[model samples]
Target: MSALIDRDEFPLLARAPELVYLDSAATTQKPRAVLDALRAYYEHDNANPHRGAYALSARATERYRAARERIARFFGLADADCAIFTRGTTEALNLVAASWGRANVGAGDEIVVSGAEHHANFVPWQQLALERGARFRICELAPDGRIDLDQLRAMLGPRTKVVAFHHVSNVLGTINPVREIAELAHGVGALAVCDGAQGAPHLPVAFDQLGVDFYALSGHKMLGPMGIGVLLGRREVLERMPPYMMGGDMIEFVHDDRSTWNVLPHKLEAGTPNVGDAVGLAAAAELLDAIGMDRVRAHEQALVRTAYERLSAIEGVHVYGPAPDARSGVVSFTVGDVHPHDLATILDARQVCIRAGHHCAQPLMRRLGVAATARASFYVYNDESDIDALVAGVRTAKELFGHATV
Candidate 1:
């Protein structure tokens, strides 16, 4: 596996050769390809894109436009103009809520969201409903941490203007039925929006096949640079919505009295733009395509399965989420009486990185009856050795906390 794609491609992994990184659900380590792309862009193509006619500016403009086209194709969106770049998933969700939600949703309208959503997907809609006097409804999670489709169906009504959810839960790693959810939302004349931050990194997503109105994803979680994300919406939907942010790039005409917004995507993306990181994100997408998303999903699935089995085998450890096939590449678990933070600290001492917190899904945490749980998420770079190291670290935590037996 290392021969296929060397771990040394990531500078941090090459430097700390012994680091077992298990927190990819937060952010992934970038490959050299992405790094070189960013550096090369700034070194050779540094200029304000789409605003100048000079040679350097034209080159930069082409690079920026190509990056958008590349990312749109990578996500299976045919019309590249529909892909809107933003800071990350949070900003993308806020864009939809602030622009589309505010325009379409009024008093007595309804917006439905799942219980397993990250704060990015949850807060914006909740606040949107509050501001619009619309009803904000949360669908409950199944016992296995998957979204309860039945409950969601019951929540949909004539007044439902939007239904938002995560394609995969950041904490539980549940892979949602996005196509079905989209269909359900459409059944009631509601637009379906998905938070694909976790999904795009681990699974193959076809926008047309899924039939969703809007999908949001972050670049940093998929081996790309930070401060970049994609908001994909249907062409008509994007064209119909108002501008998310008002500023320089997103304008078609400006006057002392009034201004007209730009095209489909540019109207959503405001300001100078993160041109270099956008180029880096395009490079990352190319690398992932070369690896084949199916293989990536398989690799993470195997690691997650091993992690679930080994972690759950511990004397008093409890793992959350559904069966191995039902979830993504994350495993959230609690050890005996040890706090998640303590367990994470012990693992960090062993040079193993893991995430420990409510994972920005405090509602799900409340449902699970725990303040937080230690999470170990896998990616293409992880292998069996990493999982073994994590299991050993958990056992060490039990021993240090005086709960080890046998």
Candidate 2:
């Protein structure tokens, strides 16, 4: 591990000294600082926000607002008013599909998404297109899982209403050129929506500089607790859309016949907010700030490049995606004649944790001509020894399956 990361800061990793956890692409383990934040919120400032006059509720409301501001600044936003809290990345993406997508995308209009998107970023747009009689076009990928930019350009036209994609691929680990994609969308007068669940955790993200109209990220993917995420939209764009859900906190004046919605963020946040998780996520942002995302990215890529090289040397192993230089920290591979589930099970016996199956990327699996591939992902706490354990486990799986190895 790099000097920037203290493994002891994460209670779960410190408790399981023998565990080789490489599934950070799914969710990262929470640090002690984040844990402490959650406990403090519940112990002292537990109350429903925005409706009460007591000191407890006031404190809760203030903490939630402060967290929103801190997180917005972390992501390079001008203010917290444009950012809305959601359950996670899935809900954030769905909120856009329900509101902005439905409002702007009409019959004969087109929605273009990359072939390498996770289902969270793919399904909603597809369903919206279907429901609204719009064309759902898939921009194909190159053989190495990189987006075919030429194909994407050819597909765009005056009818293109939205161009949605991931900042970093969950399966291929390819970091898509966000600013370039956003520019292309703008060239066609289409709105660009980015799923930042994979990018914000590993890279330094400036939301405005990316030029996207809207962006979404999950807290759990970046050392915060589960069930909390954010959706950031441009003020002008958000002001034009209707509320995603109609309920208590989202409304301003409710009458028997009709009701008016609240302001920018509260208009979309329909229910009681997740105050504790928000506080925890804010603490996570602080930790990442102190460690610096640049160092974190360098460390993980070095480990991944090493792992990719070592694994490719084995006789039965076939790694997928572009070269190590083009990828983030994830490596997906298949062992000869062994199912990914079986390989994952064997690795579990050695106290190793990795993700298997399509990784919520079934389309990409079909593109690769396989049903599934085993994935090992890295984070700040993972070191070279974890990659060694992964390689050894792959070799053992090959040996047990009667496959010859170098």
Each candidate's TM vs. the true structure?
0.98, 0.98
lDDT of 2 by residue, 1-406 (tens): 4424767988888898898999999999988999999999999998999989999999999999999999998899996799899999999999999999989999999999988899999999999999999999999997767778899999999999999999889987998999999999999999999999999899999887889998999999999999999998889899988999989899999999999999979999998999999999999999898889888899888988999999999887899998998889899999887899999999999999999999998888888899999999999988888988999999888888887432
- Candidate 1 per-residue lDDT over residues 249-273, each given as its tens digit: 9999999999999987788888898
Pairs that collide, model 2: none
Per-residue lDDT, model 1, residue 192, is 96
lDDT: worst 10-residue window of model 2: 1-10
Task: Give candidate 2 misplaced runs (Cα > 4 Å).
Answer: 1-4, 404-406
